[model samples]
Target: MEVYLVRHTETVCEKGICYGQSDVPIAAPYLEIFESIKKQLPQDAIVYSSPLVRCSQLASYLSNTIIKDDRLMEMNFGNWEMKNWDAISPDEFTPWMNDFVNVSVPNGESFVELYNRVNDFLENDFQHNTSKAVVIVAHAGVIRSILCKISGLPLKDAFNNKVGFGAVIKIVL
Candidate 1:
């Protein structure tokens, strides 16, 4: 099976905001980016998207044959949702970063938790499908989890990887 991990288009958040799982909408004029990405997809491929509006809006462009799955949603930042990163002091974020593999944000999920959810989806999909290309339109964190699972990378290094908006990454298994 081949998996195409596609990040959603740019969002309205300013550079420092932590908008994970906030259901924020994509920025305006994303149609051109969406069009360019749409051209890269397999014509007969099955598309899946996170339930978030940013992902949903882009996925809707190819709604005729796409499925929305909550499993693909980004990791919840809990109380940090919608807050500027600068507002959260290093004291708060540093500890979590130091032990992020198992630590959860206040009222939010840990990286391990996100891994389980994404793994469940991948396991189920791989078991039930064969010989077809699959495209998942989701967030940066979700894509990072998939890469971590496949590449056996440490959770801390997830941030080091860049999953730009509208970027496409293909994984084969």
Candidate 2:
């Protein structure tokens, strides 16, 4: 299967805000970016998206019908859901920053947890599909997790994948 992992465009929230799984809206004037993204995708494919609006918005533009899967949602930030990075207590943030892969936020999950769900999605849902192509519209974390799973990238080096907003990564699975 050909998996097109697409990160949703920028969100309306300002920088420094941790809005994971918050259902935030994408930045305005998304049509241009959406169109550019569309051009690179196969016209005929089953589209999947995180239930969040940001991903759903882009998925809708790409296909009339889309499958919204909770497993594709971004990592949960728990108590830090909508808090600004700077506002978070350094004492509380230091441990997670040092070991984000295994450390879950106050009430949120860690990268390990995120990777589990994404891997499950791939193994159970995506792998079972016989479609010619698959487009998944999700967040940076979700996309990165998928990349790491398929490309054998270390969890610590996930940032090296360069999952910019609206970026699309194609991988064979």
Highest TM-score, which number?
2
Tens digit of per-residue lDDT, candidate 2, span 32-142: 999999999999889999999999989999999899999999999999999999999998799999999999999899999999999898888774556679899998898
lDDT of 1 at 129: 59
lDDT of 1: 0.86
Give the TM-score comparing model 2 with the true structure, all chains together: 0.96
Q: Give stretches of model 1 more than 4 Å off.
A: 125-128
Q: What is the TM-score of each candidate against the true structure?
A: 0.93, 0.96
lDDT of model 1, residue 16: 89
**Leading candidate by lDDT:** 2
Clashes of 2: 0
As for candidate 2, its clashing pairs are none
User: Which tens-of-lDDT digit does each residue in 1-173 have in candidate 1?
Assistant: 78788999889989989998998888998888988998887767778999899998888885576788899999989999999987887877998878886899889989989989999998885434557788889999999988988898987788776899899998886
